[model samples]
Target chain A: MIPALGLIVGIALGIFLDPSVPVWLQPYLPIAVIAALDAVFGGIRAVLDGIFNDKVFVISFLSNVVVAALIVFLGDQLGVGSQLSTGVVVVLGIRIFSNVASIRRHLFHA
Target chain B: MSSTTPPPPPTDPTRQESGWSRLLEAAKPRANRKTAVATALALALGFAVATQVQATGKQGLESLRTTDLVRILDDQTSRNERLDLETRRLQATRDELVNGSSKDEAAVKAATERLNQLRILAGTVKATGPGITMTITGQPGQVTYPTLLDLVQELRDAGAEAIQIGTARVVAQSYIAEHDGALYVDNTKLTLPYTIKAVGDGDTLQAAMNFPGGIVETIRQQGAEATVTKAPSVLVDALQQPPTDRYARPVPSASPSAP
Candidate 1:
């Protein structure tokens, strides 16, 4: 419940602040968002299974974003940035679907 | 990265040997920090998501570098100016082609006789016909611009087709303006003893000039000796280039008319 409230407050702050993304970080924003989403979904699935760990969740979230951005940055240096970004998104998307499916099974029992 | 540390070996007796199964196993809840940490991460995720959406939304290109934006604007402005210049040049070329072809068609219809008449009017060729030559010897300022203008008008009225004063070929746009006691005939300065040569009916022109209270009589009243002499073949040899108009453009008219 508190996490949900924090999400709404964060959205409100973003809308009012109207923050502009820095040019240097613009290419990584979408990748980071997907990585964070994957972390959140995985954390929720862990919670449903009664195996949620605070330290593990926070560490995964941080590493997910940082690693995603790093991969894209390295790919840019190697002139394969777009392909790497696409690979990252696809992997994260599959993980999200799997975690969501687990959550659905826990909730609906189907 | 928080994953900077490697995972420990599975050594607990209660834990299973398989790695995937450990993710679903139940564990004891210890810290209140879990909810707080999740909430903060959720907030960060929400803010990033919102900002990413805004970037992709209507405010596109706002996130680009200033130099990139200026270069784009500069490229567009210069391209627009180039296109405008091209449009003007194309329009002028079109007008020239259309007008030039139509004029050529009309000129093709002008017979040899009409062509000769045009040549005479343009003063591009010599005119030889049954006409008269009149000589006027006037005082210093007696033959003013008005007197010369009246003489030319009278000759035109008497059906004098081509006329010449002194060495100047009088065309349709001819002018006589007085400048400091001398007469300027279309920018050419002429002093006394003006010889007017005209190509037309010699008898009629002589009769008109020698009429009672006419041009010759009027010139005599202005203290000038004017003589009218008829000739069978009078040659007006003064040649002048055709006048070029700068401001005036030919009015476009419909061509290919019905018979």
Candidate 2:
């Protein structure tokens, strides 16, 4: 979970400071890689003891990218790109909170 | 229990043969280790390839970021351009009002009255064509600059090719606005009941004046009287010399040039 969180945060920081980087890959890559790493490091712990559900990881990965892109495209069509970006940030903020909560629960064994 | 049941033959020859085979095969466990090592190498290679793909993916992300930045900049630039145009227009208007005549209050009132009396004299219906008349009325409260600009914008939008407020014709650089609680139309104080005249399509022009939620309605709501009429022709002289500051040079009189 710590490594997964780190990957996501790293990617986010990189994209924000250098906007030329493609944001579309942001949601899936970090989470997928982290989850894979977790599976390697802690084996059965992921299935029986880790805080994250594999399904949630996959769903968030799919939804975040698609929803964010769709919203930006829609905003462009409506002539309100800035407004759409603000919305994306809000959604991502919520996702970050949930992810942190999961991490905390897993690490604390709660 | 096995001793009692094992009398059931050798359970085929396999059990006896496997015991002999295992004793013979103990030295060849090296092959099994080699296979295990090969599998580990394959897994390691797969992991390396996955990491390489992630690096390529990061490059793609960088490209998208640049694109968003350009788009953001372009949007801001367009907004800036629009504001700049509006600022220049307002500046020109301010210059016209500051440098133009200040006696517009009396002239516009007189013109309004003249128009009203003329309307009464000419009756509601007349064969008007080329000439135009404008009416200005303000609310009891202080006149605002936005209101003044609104009137001017409406007139321009209405397609009035030629327009005059008080004694000054509307020009490319002219502006209308309010300052110090007074309404100003082109550098001149314009009290209530201002009259403006223009030359162009009378009916189309009149329709333009009373456009939805326009100055005409605003004026009427404020209890200010306004009227527009097209005349056969109304002649107007060129604008008077604009007022100048003490800092500027005095104008020479219209006289014959010295040889």
Candidate 3:
């Protein structure tokens, strides 16, 4: 509940402030978003399983975003940025799908 | 009464908790500080995501070099200025056409006058009016191409609207060149005693030629006889072939006033 409220406030602040992002970070934003989504879904799954840990959830979210961005950065240095980005997205996407499936089962039992 | 229960399984009191159960215990939310930290992190992540999405929605402008972005801005500004000027010109033309009958009549009159002026400059029609005539009788070598050219220049400077030398109409693109001890005006040969008729103010045309140290004095100095006459009506009956421009055709305007 707190995280959800935080997210809402953060989005409002972003809209009202309208701060511009730096150019160098442009390539990493999409990857980081995907990774954050994966972490959020995982956190929801943990909550359904009665094992939700705030520290673990936040750490996982930060690490996921950072690691994803780092992989893309390394790939860019190696001239394979797009390929590495696709690989990271595929892995994180699979995890998000599984977590969402579990959440759905917990909520709807279908 | 009864048989004794089966022997109880032996228990080890010193056995430690398994790693899996310990990990599950740690994964559970515990303190207020941990929850606060998580919320703060989530807020920051959300803000970053929202801002980045908004920035990306600008069609990837952030990826372009600063110089390239500035060049695109400058190009758009210049193009906008040119389009604005074109729009103003077209709007003025539209207003002139749409205002009222009196304005329309004035516009038509102005257009007709302009057309007549252009026709005169093109020399496609014969011109007759009050002006001056100059007749030059000289030795074959006395009145060269340069002398005739100078006379034409002087008449033009004195506001002679239309001019004819011998049998050739002096339009904007007329050329006079000397060849084989004679002169050719627009490729037509001229005989001696050339007669030049010009349509303008007769007094001004006469004075322009008779000005001290002007064409007349210059011609007399060269042993030629020059006579200037202010006639009530001078006729230039020569016609010019309509010029054919291979390029530079007019573009039709987009406004409704276009004809």
Candidate 4:
């Protein structure tokens, strides 16, 4: 419940402050967000599976965001930025779908 | 969410205790602090996600200052207008240059043709064609300058293209002079036998010479012999080096009545 309230407040603050992303950082944000969501859903799933660990969750979340941004940055330098970003999105998207499915089963048993 | 603890006896959030108290009770001090840290991390993650969503939600330029955006738009519009004007000016210049070149080409061709014809007419080039040659022989004083000039006039009227008499090319400026019962064509004195080479139509020139009241009858009356022969070809090899005009230049523009 605290986490949910925190998320809501964060969204409200975003709407109020209206912060803009820098041009240099814009390319990797969506990708980093997807990676973060993947980590969050993984943490939730781990909780449901009786394996929740705060250290693992924090480490995984950091690694996921960093690795996703690094892959896109490297791809940009190598002149394959868009294609590599698409690849990252596809993998992370599949993970999110499965985790959300698991979350649904845990929450509603449907 | 289920806890990684000893199974509670099928407990749910009831009127027994608050969620925070229950959560703290369920964990040791170390686990409790970890849970609090997790909640704070979740808050940060949520903030990051919200910012990302806002940033990507619409046009990337939405974050720019109004003044900066207006400046950029004004700059782009003026640049586009300038480019359009430049394109039109270049196209017009190209079209004018193309038309000028085409006109210059045709003018050059016509002028060259006219120059060659003028060269021939001015006796700068050799003249050749089928025509008649007239030879006049008379004892000392019979063949006079007036008779010779009249003969030239008659041949000119009959459309003689070129005429040469006794090493003298008869052009527009040529004059026949007689001094002391002697004839001179221009500065060259004529000998007894005067042969005139004329390039023209053979039959027409020959008939013109023999007509009544013509130079042939006048020469016969003058006790001189005028013999006309139609040749397959008559060549006037004399060329005139016309002096350049000192005080005359070509007019730049044609008069209104000029064809």
Clash counts for all predictions: 0, 14, 0, 0
Model 4 agreement with the true structure over A6-33: per-residue lDDT tens digits: 6677777777887777777777878888
What overall lDDT goes with each candidate model? 0.81, 0.51, 0.81, 0.78
Local distance difference test, candidate 3: 0.81
Q: Candidate 3 lDDT, tens digit per residue, B59-164?
A: 4666654445788999999999999999999999887767876777898999999998988889988898999989999888888889899999999999999999
| Each model's fraction of native contacts | 0.49, 0.01, 0.36, 0.31
Predicted chain B of candidate 1, TM-score versus the true chain B: 0.55
What lDDT tens digits, residue by residue, belong to model 2 across residues B7-120? 223344543334333323422334344334323332432343354355556554253444576887899999999999999999999888866655466667877887854442
All candidates in order of DockQ, best leading:
1, 3, 4, 2
Give me the runs in candidate 1 sitting further than 4 Å from their true place.
Answer: B1-31, B59-99, B102-159, B162-208, B211-259
Worst 10 residues of 2 chain B by lDDT: B1-10
What residue pairs clash in candidate 3, if any at all? none
- Residue pairs of candidate 1 with colliding backbone atoms: none
In terms of DockQ, which candidate is stronger, 1 or 3?
1
Winner by DockQ between candidate 4 and candidate 3: 3
Candidate 1 colliding pairs, count: 0
Compare candidates 1 and 4 on lDDT and give the better one. 1
Candidate 4 residue lDDT tens string, B1-259? 1221223332453612342343334333343655676667666677777888777677566554344577899999999999999999999999999999998898889989988778767778888999999999888799778889998888888889888898888888889999888888878888878899898888988888999988899998999999999998999888877768999998877765345
- The lowest-lDDT stretch of 10 consecutive residues in candidate 4 chain B is B1-10
